[model samples]
Target: MEAPPLERKLAAILAADVEGYSRLMNGDEEQTLATLTSHRTIVDALIENAHGQIFGTAGDSVLAEFPSIVHAFNSAVAIQQAMWRANQELPEDRRMNFRIGINVGDVLVKNGDIFGDGVNIAARLEGLADVGGICVSRGVRDHLRDRVDATFEDLGEHSIKNIARPLRVFRVIFDPEGDPAIDLAASPVESPETSSFVEQSLSQDRDSDDEGHRVELAFWESVQEGDDPAEYLLYLERFPNGQFVELANARLESGGTGEHDPGIELAFWETVREAGNSEMLEAYLAKYPQGQFSDLANIMLGELRGS
Candidate 1:
């Protein structure tokens, strides 16, 4: 008989770990352990209340699965808030902060345990988060975009270890009191001129006469789902002012790769300067092979790598 095929399902995974665990332990192992134990209780309760299942835990880390991505996001916010409250009265040396990351993707299920990039990405995202902060993959943000009233600041695309594609990430901004936070940076109303980007899309022929529009739509959809930087270049090459040009440029997030809006190019340079993400540097060099910042980016990348 052939072996059974492993089951797979689409779900959201939330990964979290205490920051500076080793340093905290070095200071006082007993207090650190006790505090972690106490914090887990609060985290567990909030997660359960949000309809989440805790599947894995090790030392100061937690891995949970949620059928609903929104619930995953909510529980992450709640857990962080609870942790913040727990630390308020403690001495600075005794306080503990946890970093969280959430992602929605397909995963393999076996004997009550889940495995795959879905879980892997969540774990890696945790590493990128600041202490006591939450980072979410693009998929999770998209699912919660309209349904949840919260601010998600784009951190740009990242080249995660072992992941096939560079994943786009976002940082969540939530109120500790649990009130939904509005994205103040967003304009409530859009003028017709500003909405032009939405009006133009994969229909590249400048006319979208009929058959040409359909073909472009298919390619655009593929590019969106594929998350392939090269495909984004192709999309832009075909339609410079395409509807998704900005989005495609964002996904590309580099200096030169291909022609792009001058405004977006400046933004990329500024973000590269601010974040100093090595992946961003690499992407910059790769996309904008002949970009103005190519030499500077190369120098910085070399310094980062000690090359």
Candidate 2:
């Protein structure tokens, strides 16, 4: 006799995996295994706290289902935040970053494991998240407008693997300007930005403490000399706990290049001029308080009173 059809339901699903699990394992198998085990323990607890069920897991990937979309989104953010805190003490290479994706849709359930396009889409969305970041489908984002206390930025439509239609994706902005390694824009598929960062750091690894210190000094001096935000970001990616991490972060947040993009400033002005509303000027100031035309924007804001 043929088996009966599997149980099915609409649910919110989350998929997550270590961003550089393969490379980390290849670099140090034993240590990688231990670290993954520890991280899984933490993730499992967080999932439960959010009232989600871990339906499946692979070597380094986690699949969980939540009854509520908000719960699932909150859980993803919490997990990343917790991992960020835990990673503070770990060295650059030893630190593990996770990419998470959440979606809400119909799913097939059999023997407590969830399947179907819902799960598949969530997994694909995970591939689009930057290291230590979250990406959610339009379905998930739709429910988060007033429910979650967080920011969601539209990533526009993206073509994902195995999905015929392009998915409307949004990035869950946990910390917009905090860490470049974690805040960089994600590509449709996994981008090499984070991986290249990891590879560069790995290549600089040294067996001698003296040699490693010298290398660290060399990188630090390079960043100081260049005074480029990208160089500073690279420095932080390689040495999360380096002596200049705090300074680097401050520079990136303060527009380290010493100026805003002229194109961006011009576009902001154009937008405000076309709209001719206080709201638009307010938005301009909010995004760029010290923008090239801040004074003009403020004057416009006052002129368009109560707008």
Top lDDT hit = 1
Q: Give per-residue CA lDDT, model 2, range 6-98, as digits (tens).
A: 988999999999988999999999667756754665577578767788978889999999988977887788778757755654679989889
**Candidate 2, residue 111: how far the Cα is off, in Å:** 2.6
The all-Cα superposition gives candidate 2 an RMSD in Å to the true structure of 20.5
Listed per model in order, the count of residue pairs whose N, CA or C atoms clash below 3 Å is: 4, 0
Q: Looking at model 1, which ten-residue stretch has the lowest summed lDDT? A: 179-188
Off by over 4 Å in 2: 2-5, 176-307
RMSD for each of the candidates: 23.0, 20.5
Q: Candidate 2: what lDDT? A: 0.73
**What's the lDDT for all of these models?**
0.74, 0.73
- TM-score for each predicted model, relative to the true structure: 0.57, 0.57
For candidate 2, give the lDDT of residue 198. 68
Steric clash pairs (candidate 1):
200-243, 256-288, 257-287, 257-288
